[model samples]
Structures are given as C-alpha cells and as structure tokens.
Target: MTDATLTQTGREPRSAGALIGRRLLRWGLYALLCLFALYYLLPLFVMLTTSLKSLEEIRTGSLVALPREVTFDAWGKAWSGACTGIQCEGLRPFFWNSVMMAVPGVLLSTLIGALNGYIFAQWRFRGANLFFAFLLFGCFIPFQVVLLPMARMLGIFGLAGTIPGLIFVHTIYGLGFTTLFFRNYYVTIPHELVRAAKIDGAGFFRIFWSIFLPLSLPIAVVTIIWQFTQIWNDFLFGVSFSSAGSQPITVALNNIVNSTTGVKEYNVDMAAAIIAGLPTLFVYIVAGKYFIRGLTAGSVKG
Candidate 1:
C-alpha cells in the first residue's frame, strides 16, 4: 500500500462528524468566555457610570443604570480638591507619596536581589546553602509577625513615620521574594557564560554587569512588576510605617472613603478610587507584554 493510504487507514483522520463537534465545542467555549468577561466587567461599568453621575441621579436611579448626564467634575475634584482627612487638597500628595515610596523600594529591592541571586548562582562558598535557606525562609514569614520589632527598629533609627522608613520597610520585606525570582530565573541560565567572561580577565561585577544584566530583561520585568504592585497597593505598611503628610495613596483613599461628618459623596469616592488605581493599572497595561515573556523565559534549560 502507498504510505498515504497506509497513514489514512492507520490513523483515520478526523471525520466530518468529529470536525463539526469540535467547531460546536469551540463556539460553546467562546460563549462561556464572553460570559466570564461580562461577569467581571459589570461592576467596573457600574462604578464608571456612577462616578460620572450627579449625586441626585445616583440617589434617584438604579446603581447599574447608565448615567443620564455625564460630568468630569467629580474626576477633577478627586484629583485636586477632595478631602482626605483634614487635608482638603485631594489625592495628589498622597499619590506622590506612594510613587516616591514605591519607586525607591522597587529599585533597591530589585538591585539587591540581583546581586544576591548572582552570588547564590555563581559564587558558592562554605555554608552558602544554609544562608540561602534562611534568606528564602524570609519569603514565607508573615509581616504581621514582625511588625512590633520592625516598628521598634524604625524608632531606633529615628525613621518612624518617615518616607525613608516606609521605603526601608518595603525593601526589607520585598527582598526575599525578589531574590527568589532572580535566583530561580538565573539557575536556568548556563554558567558557561560566566566561565567564559572570567577567562577574559573580567572580575565579578564586570562579568555580571556586562554579560548577565543584559540578559536579565525577562526576570527583571517580573521583579519590577511584582515589587511595584505590592508596594504601591500596600495599605498596612502605608498606614503603620508612615503618618500624616507622608501616607501613601492607599491610606489616603481609606481615610477619604471612611470619613465621617459629611453627607456621603459616593461619586467622589468612586472617582478617587479610580484615580488611586490608575497608575498601577497603567503600569500593568503597558508592561503586560513583559509579563508573558517572564513567565516563559525560565522554562528552557540551557
């Protein structure tokens, strides 16, 4: 028999009946996915419409109904004029506070993690595994368990209630996870490159800076996104480690959302929530491409 005939007989390629069933299954799956999308997006749509509507409209109409009249005044007020505590200057200052805290925390933690990972990956001395074990253990330790000690330490350094203190807190807590990210990712990288660079008379930092750092893009994206999101959205650390004018956006939003002594301004509250969230959302939307790369970058062992 010819090879084509033999193949067709042995494997009886999918029949018309099977193909029709598969097409039906696929369309059914697509319909389910569309339903799931609407399920999640419905709340967001309601919030957007409510935020744009006037107080009277919100009071008189259905919560999920589309706004009859849209206005951007609530957005403007949320940005620059809303009351977040006694400070009636809006969420801008707190927003900047979060930006300042998150940026430095992410940078410091990521750099330290890269160095620690390189050390663990390349230069193993005696007791290295033991030390690395302890370091990894930090990743699982609950922050609440150490809060008192951390507060005392901050006070000792006169960093209590300061921006620097908040940065230090985030960096310290963030290090273990970032280190794990880089360490696991780097293990998949071949050590032959390091050996080759060493043969060229490159020192440790020289080889790392020139050779490995360039290839660190995928893991770096993962690290930055992880750290930025954690630090930006942290309410506990923001409230605990910082106070007054130095609180991050999360803390400010909480105060505004829960404030007493006024008729509840639901529209402003929704707008403020959106403003507080937009930065991290923007970051994710912009760098989401890197997230996919990061997930798969360490899959292959070379």
Candidate 2:
C-alpha cells in the first residue's frame, strides 16, 4: 500500500474510537440527568400516588408503589368537603380568594412597575436615582419586618382580614421586585424611542401607552410569573393579614394538613397540598420557557 494510504487507514480506528467515546460520554450524562430528575420528582410522585390510594392501601403498600386501585375521592374531598378545624368547607372559597387577590395584585404591580421603569430608564429626572435606590432597599426587607406596620396600615384603611386587603398587601410588597425587573429590562431598550415619541409631541402617558407598553411583554411575563407565584404561595401574609373567611388557599392547605380533629386523612392532606400548588405549577408549566427567555432578554443590558 502507498504510504498515504497506510496513514489514512491508521487514523480511521482512532477517529472511530474517539467518536465512540463521545457517544458513550453523552449517554452517560443523559442517564445521570434522568436519575437526578427522578430523584427530585420522587416526592411529587409519592404525593400523587398517595392521593390516589385508599388509606388501607396506603398503609399496606410501599410508599413508592403505584395505587392498586385509583380513586379521586381525596381530590373531591380536598376541593369541597375536607375539614379545617370547625369549618368543613374545603379549599373552594379560599382558592377563589387567591385567584381574586393574585390576579389584581399581579396586574397592578406589573403596570405600576412598567411606568416606574419607563421613568427610571428614559425620563432621567432629578432625584430619580435616589427614589430608585429606596425602591431597591424595599426589595430586601424581610416579610416579618413589615408584618406589624403593614397590619396597622391595613387596620387604618379598614381593609383588615379581607381579600382586597391581601391584594393591596401583595401589590405593595411586590412593587420593589416588579419595578426592579422592569427597570432592568427597560434599560435594555434604546432611549431614542422615548425621544422620538417626545418629538412627535407624545406626552409621557401617551408615549408609554403607545410605545413602551407594547414592547413590555417579555418583562411583563417575568414579572407576572414572579408576582403570582409569590402571592399565591404566601402563607405568612395570608395567615397574618386575613380572617378565616378571607384566607388564601395556602393557609387553608396548612389548616387541612394540621387539623387534628379526626383519623388523620393522609390522602386528603396530600390532595389538598397538590390543589393548593396546582395554579403555580400550571403557571410554571405553561410559561416556564417564556420566563427563561424573558430573563435572558433583560440580562443583556442590566
């Protein structure tokens, strides 16, 4: 064989071996990731299976085992019939309570944040940085620190222990986060847009409504997801600020899980936990990709 032919033939085996090694490494990584996914998902799997089981079957079977006979009685009870203390009313009312509070809270905070972001990013007024710094400070305040003052404010407003009260509280608390998100995102937009709008005699509100708001979808998604998840899952504020009737589903779920009145209904507890968690889960499942995209979109400038 020619020398070139021999050299070419000799390289083939090494190349093939390298390719095989890469394939094996890739498959190993995939397997490792799958194992980790299963490990993290184990609790949710157990909760779903346990919720489907009869108490007798749960006692008899392994914790990780699938149900012998599937039933949604626990789900039904959790939604409408489960007892929390003296009240047997399930999570229905409280679920609606959360929806009412979260929807308005997310909208209000996002809208106000968008406006604040617009001003901070493009308006460039005096003392803007100082005010923005104060907002940044607000973001770091702990939930416990605001409990007393916020409670007193709610009392003064006569909104104590009401759904609207919860809405107001979440909106106010979420403002810092929403404003920060929008400000960072808005900074990424060219300032020329605002200037061009101003040249067209567009007033502040007009320019924001016509130009900025339309381009706000990405950061808005991020802000909405953040606020909704926070507000929906909040237990401290829900419990501390609301009466029994106005409590959010998180509080109700806690009540259901901790209720000591009867033969501990493990199935109902699991189901209730899942129910309380479903909205946020659904939100994440649907908008999770958008959330990542939005975060990356704003990350370039801020």
lDDT per residue for candidate 1 within 34-96, as digits (tens), equals: 788889988888879989999889899999999999998888888888887777888889999
Tell me each candidate's TM-score: 0.91, 0.91
Residue 132 CA displacement from its true place in model 1, Å:
2.3
Compared with the true structure, all predictions reach lDDT values of 0.86, 0.89
The residue-level lDDT of candidate 2 at 188 comes to 82
In model 2, the Cα lDDT at residue 163 comes to 93
Q: How many pairs in model 2 have backbone atoms within 3 A of each other, for residues 3 or more apart or on separate chains, i.e. clashes?
A: 0
For residues 6-67, what per-residue lDDT tens digits would candidate 2 score against the true structure? 11223344577786786676667667777888889899999999999998898889999999
